[model samples]
Target: MAAELYPSSLTTSIPNDPAVTPSSKKSIIQEPDQETEPAPTSTQPNANSSTETGSRWQASHPTLRERNALMFNNEHMADVHFMVGSPGETQRVPAHKYVLAVGSSVFGAMFYGDLAEEQCEIQIPDVEPAAFLTLLKYLYSDQIELEADTVLATLYAAKKYLVLALAKACVAFLETGLEAQNACVLLSQSRLFQEPELSQRCWEVIDAQAELALRSEGFSQIDPPTLETILRRETLNAREAVVFRAVVRWAEAECRRRGLPVSTANRRAVLGKALYLVRIPTMTLQEFADGAAQSDVLTLEETHDVFLWFTAAVKPALEFPAVPRTGLTPLRCHRFQSSAYRSNQWRYRGRCDSIQFAVDRRIFIAGLGLYGSSGGKAEYSVKIELKSQGTTLAQNRTKFLSDGSSSTFSVWFEHPVQVEQDIFYTASAVLDGSELSYFGQEGMTEVQCGKVTFQFQCSSDSTNGTGVQGGQIPELVFYG
Candidate 1:
């Protein structure tokens, strides 16, 4: 019985017209033929039906109309869904006709610009409708999703479309990604694309990762054209130039360190080619030696030349400036005078000795005599002494009696001499204790001639006389 009822229910058919038989109308009401009729793609009528259960169904069986209405509503709903989630933009674009939203359509237009003329459809990835719409927003307003990873490629495509905003977004992404550790590929692409900002960012990253740059074999990996571009960049200073030179030099050093046959034909040729291409600073050993001898400081380029030259000529020369002189004489005072002191039974008054002394002063004293017997032969000896007060400081005695009895004596104080003030060469000597006297051709500093005991006769005979010619004792004179 169950199998028979299932067949009957499965074959149930709704009447096409309400004027049909009663059983046909009842079948349309209860056991409708869902299998025979085309199902509505919008919704199925069952437990969740809104178009079911009512006396309004008997008047007209509105299945086809209802289905058409549901389909139209669904299409409308689809339009609304896209408006909220995946909506795109279109315009009666200007003469340029470029003001279109980004997405598959824009990319398709771009891809079409350079594509072969005749094509049916383009095979592209199934981009999310939402993402495609987001891209369209970007094209229309230059707004982008910050967290969207595919935005970079989308920008690239947009850039191809000559969209200025999309190009800028691409540049920003490349530069930001270039800052990361494993962003060499991205940076390389940026450089290839001739993006100035991205290239600068990549160079900054290279400068920051010096060790990584050194280890990467990137020096050799970079072609001559690329290196030329980098080297020609005027932004590099002396320090950065040194780093650049080091990178190129490392390739040669690495070859040697690895025990590679650097002298081989191919290797030598390659090296020569590199030398020409690199335009690294070059100096002969002689030129380097001359530079070192002449200059204390050199720029990085000059230093590179010197290093290269030394590698060839193999000289061990140190580079530095010469040290300059550094030695110290004792001060000598030949003539010195202190404040005057008093001694002896008699008092002596004087001011400070106002004699200006010179290092080349000549002070000499002549012979000093005592009596007629000429005590200077014994006690009348011409004894000159330098004294501080009554204390004898230095004394020298020189006998001035000539063998021919022609007395002539003099003693010069060659260095310096001092004398007391107010009592200089006075008619009478000031005696602190004894007067200093000069004897003829002797060392006497002063003379006291009032003590003469021998009377001088005005006779030329050999007797004691005050005769300037024949009769002579010892005439004394002073020179100050």
Candidate 2:
């Protein structure tokens, strides 16, 4: 198979074997006069060979990798220069053609194939200097050190060179750090790179925590196609109003990038087809009246159509989809199997029923499932909080009127809290009620809900009858 070169302008065509076709643009750099060491040749010893001879051979000759490492950036035997980076930030990296050829088939075809061009320097304007150096290090020493800031750039360089191992490593690193904060940005890159698995993982986080992901600064930086993809997603868990606001923010950013004034017209122009995917008619009448109408992004006719569709018995034909999105249904992960209403037990006196929990992957904690009053219909004022290391991540004060049943009642937070992997968080709830309620028994230390596995531990703040063994907090409602 013929290996394709990145920056298609760099080469016309090169065979799979050792050869390269240089770019049309070329520059010559004077070669340094330094003593050069010949490339090392390795010979394997016989299986019956003595340990003494093997030790002597090892002492006299360093491994091939060690020699390659020594010649990595050394100009001693370098025959080519790579002019990497952009115009003002260019860097000339000296490298041995044979070593790079041995590591990457693309490099092999570029430097020593049948159609190889005899150029002293190759212009690499698309890749960063740091990322290029990292690639060279991996090729020379079979080792790579990746940092969060430059890993994406390094991945680009790896894919360009057809370095499959390094590219896989970069993808793994990115997947490990995937979260709601960076999922949008990663989703864009993953789609650009044709990495479907990474894109799907990113979509999972974005779908579960749509509001948070859309509100992220990275969402505004996504390309137009990626923005459209998000808008068209039917499983997004955010409300239509939130989606419209995020799209407006993205359009404003895009207008500024294009050096246009931030006007309603400019925003609509930048949004283009993406604006139609917001499902404005699906939004509540109050939401549409308060947000979309005041924004001025929608024209008078479009606004009128939406109002008629909402109130009029005969709905008008609208461009936007009127149906609400099929948002994610959070899974209720019960930590206990049985519940009991003991006499004088499960009484709430405002003491917090807290339990520490952690997950193996990023998930949105929508709410908590608690046992309601078993002594007839009762109303309780509840304060629910999620904390990490004493710092409150999310808190909500609400009221729930239990129907005096054995089923768990879900009390939701104002917004879902994004829980990161392996980070311990405390879910605490204080219920102010006069009735003795059903308490959980036969508590579990771990519960699997869909793809997320939550591990529970006893919290020091649990002063009431709520804990890993027995508690009022029976379940954690979450969307993975």
Candidate 3:
């Protein structure tokens, strides 16, 4: 009883049922964990697995992580390499982050239109590989970024790659920045490229639009020499000389218009220089005529003499068929047609021979022929006649030389010799070289004896020799 009273403050604890075992209690306390980590399976690794294993950890659950894991771990994830620094360089960068350079911001903008619509976003991956790097560099630098030597290389590559927009943008940059000299250098270098259109556009922008090129001010201008080089490369066309000559004419005209006082001598020298430079047809007819006109400092008569010299230059060209005259015979001696009788034909019958030439609209006849066998040297004349209105073209004279005068004395005749009244015939003895022999054979009379050809004029006034007469109609006969 006393023990029970003393233990009241610390009463001994007792099992409710006294039947529960230690193992059973432990099992009850370790009830199934609500948030236990997943077990390591063949298909799933622990989140805190080894460094190699932990890399497999993904942000989402097992299904999503497993789906993307294979793709994310691909060995070829590295981006494509892109060239940098300059168009022709070996340095490269990742394709995704690159930019391009262009000359004019506007030029690049213009290229945007010609480029395929989808290409505008600058999706470098989708573009042709060749232009990608260069175009990217252009975007970044706003320039071609090619060395002077490598510009041609870049252009060729761009053209070959069908990156026309990039190629044209590069060309525009070069044309705007490079001087005429450098522009010419580029042209000479790219004369045989695949992009003729590009080259031509470059030239128009550089050379034709340049002020010095238009005015052709200096002796050392780049355009002239540049053109010379181009011509040497290709077969120069003849018609192109038209444009070349036009440039020359414009230069000369401008000089004059500006009161530059270009002397005839200086102008000629410049023209000759230009001709030589351009390889134009040497000594053209127009050039010769203009040069000759300017150079001849002489009086009207002296100028006429000079003109005769000029005419001689073109005689072969202007020569017509000896003023065609046919069926003209002295006294209608058809027998003279025989080769045997022709030798002395003039000795028996009369023949008329002379040339009617115009000197300042005045007609004169000078030639010789036998009047008859007995007349001998006494039958010849140096005659002058006035031309009538109806003569449009000159007629040829066909007559043999007289027996007395040497054959070298063959005459070039002109007008028809008719001894009729209203037509006052002027004749003189060939032997005397003197005395006016004026004979008047009139009244329905026809003097049809001629060993030579002659031209007849239809006149209106009878007494006016210098004036035309209007009385009769002359007969003309052509045998052959």
Each model's total of backbone clashes: 20, 8, 32
State the lDDT of candidate 2 residue by residue for 220-313, as single tens digits: 8777888989998989999999999999999988888778899989999999988999899888999999999889899999999899999999
Candidate that scores best on TM-score: 2
After aligning candidate 3 to the native by TM-score, how far in Å is the CA of 423 from where it should be?
81
TM for every model, in the order presented, reads 0.28, 0.85, 0.22
Backbone clash total for model 3 is: 32
Model 1 over residues 1-480: C-alpha lDDT tens digits? 011100112112111111111111110011133323332322221223344324354244455434322322122212111221112431111111123422335444543466522432222232332333334444433344432334434444444445565556646644433322323333444554557777665554444343344344434334334444444433332133343344345444434544565443434333433333322333334544554323423446555655654575653343321111110011121111111212221121321111111112222222122212221232223434333333432344443332322133333222112222222221111112122222222212233333211111222121222122221123322223
lDDT of each: 0.32, 0.79, 0.31
Q: Which segments of candidate 3 are over 4 A away from where they belong?
A: 1-150, 188-191, 194-197, 202-229, 232-480
Best by lDDT: 2
Please provide, for model 3 over 1-480, each residue's C-alpha lDDT reduced to its tens digit, 9 standing for 90 to 100: 111100111111111111111111110011142222332212221223344234544443255223223222122221234333333433433422111113333333434445423332222222223334444333322223443333444554455444555566545544433332343434533454435655664354332323322223221222343444533322221223232443455445434544565554444444443433332223344653454334422234533543454456543222111221221222221111111113322221122222121111111232233222222343343232323233322233343323432222323334322121133222221222312222111212222334333323322333222111111111222111
Q: Indicate the TM-score of model 3.
A: 0.22
